[model samples]
Target: MIPEFWGNGIAANPDNYLDEDEFDSSYEGLLRLSERIGDAKPKGVPEHVIHTLPTKPYLMSKARSPDERCTICLSEYEHNDWLRDLPCAHDFHKECIDSWFKNSDKCPICRRSILENKEL
Candidate 1:
């Protein structure tokens, strides 16, 4: 057989289509089931870990540039805005990032695990 597809071995298998028919039910149902079963996704970090994230008032003088904005809120940070600094060194508004931690344990920009130094 001649090599037709170029990457990732997906082309090697002739039946490459997703079995969507088997998954036709709404995603919300699956999400709810997963939430109840507690296995569809990896668990997020503990609340204490989130609460311990370092935060400081935004100081324009400390920023590398004035154009820095929180990727979560997509707004240029204003002076004195409370911001949380992730271990990856990325910062976001306190409210913005705190809300984010409720759902994920990784940095939004770099995807670094926020569980780095925490126990449990």
Candidate 2:
């Protein structure tokens, strides 16, 4: 069997592990890979929903700091960097996670549905 490498370490599958009901992708993981190809919005996570999430510039403080770097970019954030607060309360560099949300709507660390809480 030949394996397909959808650029950037993502792959396609027919095993149905993360089917629509389980993970909400129209074509397993390929839907996300396509978003990378041309910046198109994935079917399930529309731009409107993306806009619904709360985003703001980072404000460093003793209580709230960029202690946690973005899981997507693997770089520490500096003060004044933009941040996106997911419905799960976990935040990430706006640019890093914004690109990420364009592909998938799950929180990077907790895998929570980004739309679970509307109060954000």
Candidate 3:
């Protein structure tokens, strides 16, 4: 007997079509679960990783000056503004960086792990 639909092994297999529907659902589930895996804060990170980082006031000094703006908010750093100094020595607004670290442990600019060289 001849096959009703003849082609490569996959196209000839009727089960493949049925599996495609199931596979799409499975793929969607996986995508939803990992949507935040890249560049986003993965679930289960501890809050202290952010809180433990150093924070200081943005005092106007010849030293420790800002980069003309806050990298996080993209706004200029006013006098007496707060800063969250990363382990890499890059600083951002306290509120901005703190909110950032909650989602990630790396510096937004340097991409260095804020956890680097620190005893956890």
- Write candidate 2's Cα lDDT for 1-120 as tens digits: 434555323455456345656654458566776666764544335567777778887666766544557778887766788888887788888777778866686888998877665433
Model 3 C-alpha lDDT per residue in residues 1-120, reported as the tens digit of each score: 345546555568776665555554577777865674553535323576677777887767666544667888899887788888777889999888877766677788988886667665
Which candidate ranks first by lDDT, i.e. highest? 1
Taken over the whole model, the C-alpha lDDT of each candidate is 0.83, 0.70, 0.72
Query: Candidate 1 — which pairs collide?
Result: none
For candidate 1, write residues 23-95 as lDDT tens digits: 5358896887667778766667677888888999987775367458899989988889999999899999999
What is the Å distance of residue 24 in model 3 from its true position?
4.0
Clashing pairs in 3: none
Top model number, TM-score: 1
User: Residue 97 of candidate 1: its Cα lDDT?
Assistant: 89
Q: Show model 3 residue runs off by greater than 4 Å.
A: 1-18, 25-45, 61-66
Per-model TM-score, in order, reads 0.66, 0.54, 0.61
